[model samples]
Target: MQPYKKLFTYWFAVIIYDLTVDFTKSYIKSFKLKEQMDGAARSGKQNIVEGSEGMQTSLKSAIKLTGVAKASFEELIGDLEDYLRQNNLKQFPKNNPKIEIFRQKAAVLIKKLSDFYKNESLVRNLSNLSYLEKYFNTSSVEEKVNLLLTLCHQETFLLNKQVLSLEEKHKTEGGLTEKLYKARVQHRGY
Candidate 1:
């Protein structure tokens, strides 16, 4: 499959998993947390799409971007687990049965791409792009570039969105109130 397409599929799986969690919730206790998760999920998919588009022009840039995407998803997963535990939700089902199907599919695709890139030629060329080279060993230029781009976009998008949503929620929840109050107190004291 085209590298971009595979990346997109992986990202889409993440989104679906998030949606499942969101919909199954019996309570709406933490809107902010929910929003963050949703945003992270969207970001994962969006990044993949963006990276794929970027690859059409700059392979190197695309690879870097895909790296960002991969990081984002990994972060989101960590966040999800934390949130679940903090909220006293039951342990994520064995292998996360709820999202296992999608997770498995994404894992397989990522492994396949990783294996394909473990060729000697691609590895030598990628060495110059050190950050991206770690993703593959060696493969054709097109394959290596595409895979890197896909991963970057997916992960970055997820991380960025989750962070943004969290920030927004904090702002809405009086997190900035202390700063504002301090400023007012300083002005009065002056």
Candidate 2:
């Protein structure tokens, strides 16, 4: 199985990219902001994919790429925060009931994606973006921004956890170079 395909962070990054594209089209008038938002979202998704792909060969590379993904999402969150601040929109606090609801729903969506990947062989697509769109369809743009902010927070948290896990594994197992040296020594009957 492709490890990244099973990751909620990777799936959510894809969703963020698609939704940010659509969101910017309707709400943002500045081309620079639009491009930055889309690019950051895309970068987050791409880095996760690359990191997962490289994991077997080099845990260090995987860790670095995962860090890049986390940083990219951080940039996207900053852009979203700027958007809210500039427009004088209210961002929901961590303890808000609406944020709790969003977090619950987000967890469900992640589980759904994880199950789908486990049972099906399918290419990555925007098939699941509609779930998020429908979830906030009735909300105002400010609410949408809040939801996305909540999402970014969740994703960054997951990314950090993933990185720590990777670091621990790397420390225990060593990396590609160490493995290669061991294998070469064994093959030479050392």
- Give all candidates' CA lDDT scores: 0.47, 0.85
> Best candidate, TM-score-wise?
2
* Worst ten in a row by lDDT for model 1: 141-150
Q: Cα miss at 171, model 2 (Å)? A: 0.1
Which residues of candidate 1, in runs, are more than 4 Å off? 1-3, 6-21, 24-28, 90-190
Model 2: per-residue Cα lDDT over 6-73, one tens digit each: 88888778767778887898899999889999999899999999999999899999999999999999
Give residue 165's error in model 1 in angstroms.
31
Please give the lDDT score at residue 42 for candidate 2. 90
Candidate 2 lDDT (Cα, 0 to 1): 0.85
TM-score of each: 0.42, 0.92
> How many steric clashes between backbone atoms does each model show?
17, 0
Clashing pairs in 2: none
